[model samples]
Target: MSAFDGVKVAVLLFVAAIAQVSIFGQLHVFGAVPDILLVTLVAISLLRGSVAGAVGGFFAGLIVDTASLGTLGLTSLVLTLSGFWIGRYGETTGRDRAHAPYLSIAVVTVLYELGLLVVHFVLGESAPAGAVVRSLLPAVVLNLIVTGPVYGLVRRLLRAMERQELSAEVQLLG
Candidate 1:
């Protein structure tokens, strides 16, 4: 990965984390919250690939774990696996803007909840079906709803970064 890409990813992680914790929590529907980090990971996976997805998920999850009542590394592990699978799928399947990200995010929100369930179970925590249904369902819906616009932003940022890279390359070759 280019150093620029790394920097971009870092900035994304930072913003995503802050947005998740600060802004997203402020807006509530059905007593639910939007998971910007989750959406970000899915978008990154669809737009880039599994490796980038994994890194994004890892950082996002780690931040969540530290920021909330949940156990440490739970989100990290879940998000990392989610990102890996998402990225791997992206690599095998051609990305189409019309529906790929929406489809991926739709499915992934469920997978993310599933991963959380498994982690909670492994940790000997009680499995509350209502947690996902009552709380996370709305969160998932909100994430899917926001995915399109957020994905566009990520795309725009990537294109800008790509232009910078291209300019740098041309200057080097001059």
Candidate 2:
């Protein structure tokens, strides 16, 4: 990716992180807040590759951790893994799939919540498995609901870079 592309992604994630903590974080529906940052990260990962996803995940997660004054590096770890795996999926079997975004969002939402629970347990914090399980369906639903528009916007924003990346992948294959 070009320097400009990197800057654009950074700015995008920065805005996403800020909005996530400030706005979406406050709005609760069905006792669950929509994870806009996670959806945005997934969209970027689906367009970019593992490295970009990992970096973007870390950047966004750090912003979230800082903004919320929560445990440092907690979100970073989970989101980094989530982004990398999603990016790999995009690079491999999910690139052209119509349901990639929806599938990724649904699966990652579950995994992200489970990951947080596990981490909290390990750290002797309040795990609250019951609450997480109760909220899982709603969170996944909310994320999937936003996936179409978020993915479209992200894909549109990164269209040039995505084309370049796809051409490079094709050339590599041939």
Candidate 3:
């Protein structure tokens, strides 16, 4: 990625982190808040690559942790994993798939929640697995619902980078 591309992604993640904490944090639909940051991170990972995803995840997660005043590094770990795996998925099989965004959102939403629960349990924190599971469906639905718009916007924003990456990959294959 170019320096400009990196800057663009940083700005995007920063805006997403802010929106997530300030706006979506307060909006509860069906007893579940939509994870705009996660969805945005997924979009970035799918568009960029594993390294970009992991880095963006860590940066965004740190911003979120600071903004929400939650346990530092907790979100960073989870998001970094999510971003790397999803970016790998994109690099291998998901980039050309139309359902990639929706599928990624659904699957990651489930895993993200469970991962958080597991981490909390490990940390001896209150890990309400039952409540998290109960709310899982709604959160997944909410995330999937927003996937279309978010992915589209992200793709559009990163169109130039996508073209560059594709050409580079094609040359490598050739």
Note the Cα lDDT for every prediction shown.
0.80, 0.93, 0.94
Whole-structure CA lDDT of model 1: 0.80
TM-score of 1: 0.84
**Which of the two, 1 or 2, has more TM-score?**
2
Best first by lDDT, ranked: 3, 2, 1
Q: Would you list the clashing residue pairs of candidate 2?
A: none
Looking at candidate 1, the ten consecutive residues that score lowest on lDDT are: 94-103
Candidate 1 residue lDDT tens string, 3-97: 78777876887788778877886888886777788777777777678888888888888887787766878889989998888888777874654
Backbone clashes in model 1, listed as residue pairs: 49-87, 50-87
Per-residue lDDT of model 2, residues 1-174, tens digit only: 778788878888999899999999999999788999999999989888788899999989999999999999999999999999999999999989999999999999999999989999999999999999999999999999989998998888889876887899999999
Total backbone collisions for each predicted model: 2, 0, 0
The superposed Cα distance between candidate 1 and the true structure at residue 142, in angstroms, equals: 1.0
1 or 3: which has the higher TM-score? Answer: 3
